[model samples]
Target: MKNLQPIISVESDAKMSKCRTLIMLISPTLVLAIIPIFLSFIIKKLILMTFLIFFGFSSLAMSASDIYFFIVILLKMRNNELFYQEDNKIYILKK
Candidate 1:
C-alpha cells in the first residue's frame, strides 16, 4: 500500500515550537495569578485548625478540600493531552 500521509514540514515544525514556547511562557503567569486563591484556602484551613486546637480537639485529619487540592495539583503536574501521530494524522487525547 502506498503511504499517503503528509510529512510535517519545517515551517509547521517552527510554528509548533513557537506555540509550545508561548504556552510555556504563559503557564507560569497563570499559575502566579492563581496562587493567591490557593493561599487563601490554606490560610482558611489553618484558621480552622487553630480553632479546633484551642477547643482541645486535637485530631487533625485531612479535609475534603485538602484532598481536592492535592488531586488538582497532581493533575496539573501531569500533561493534560497526549499527542499521537498515526497514519500521517495527529491525534490529541485528553485526560
Candidate 2:
C-alpha cells in the first residue's frame, strides 16, 4: 500500500504582518500627536500653538474612524483567504 497525504498552509498578505498592519493603520494618530510637539519648538506663538493643538486633537477622530474601517477591511480580506479542501492538508491563499 501507498501512503497519501496533503500539505496544509496558512495564508496572509505578505506585506501586512499583524504588527506592521496595525502600526501602519494607527500611525496617522501618532503623527497627529507628534506635529503639536514639534510645533512647540519652532512656533513661539502660544495662540497658534493652541490652535494647532486643537486641530491635531480634532483630527484624531477622523483618523480613528479611518483605522476602524481599515481593520474591518483587513478582517474581511483575511476571512476570504480562508479556503479549505476536503483532503489531508489545507492551503491558504495570500495576496
lDDT of the candidates, in the order given: 0.40, 0.58
- In model 1, pairs of residues that clash are none
RMSD of 2: 15.0
Mind giving the per-residue lDDT tens digits that candidate 2 earns over 9-90?
3334344444455565567666876576567568879898888777777766657654784576567546335333244443
lDDT of 1 by residue, 1-95 (tens): 57743342222322223234335434433343344344444665777645544433221121233334345444543355543335456454555
Candidate 2 Cα outliers beyond 4 Å, as residue runs:
1-15, 34-44, 67-95
Clashes in each model (backbone N, CA, C under 3 Å)?
0, 0
Q: State the displacement of the C-alpha of residue 95, model 1, in Å, after optimal TM-score superposition.
A: 28
Candidate 1 positional error at 65, Å: 32
- lDDT for model 2 comes to 0.58
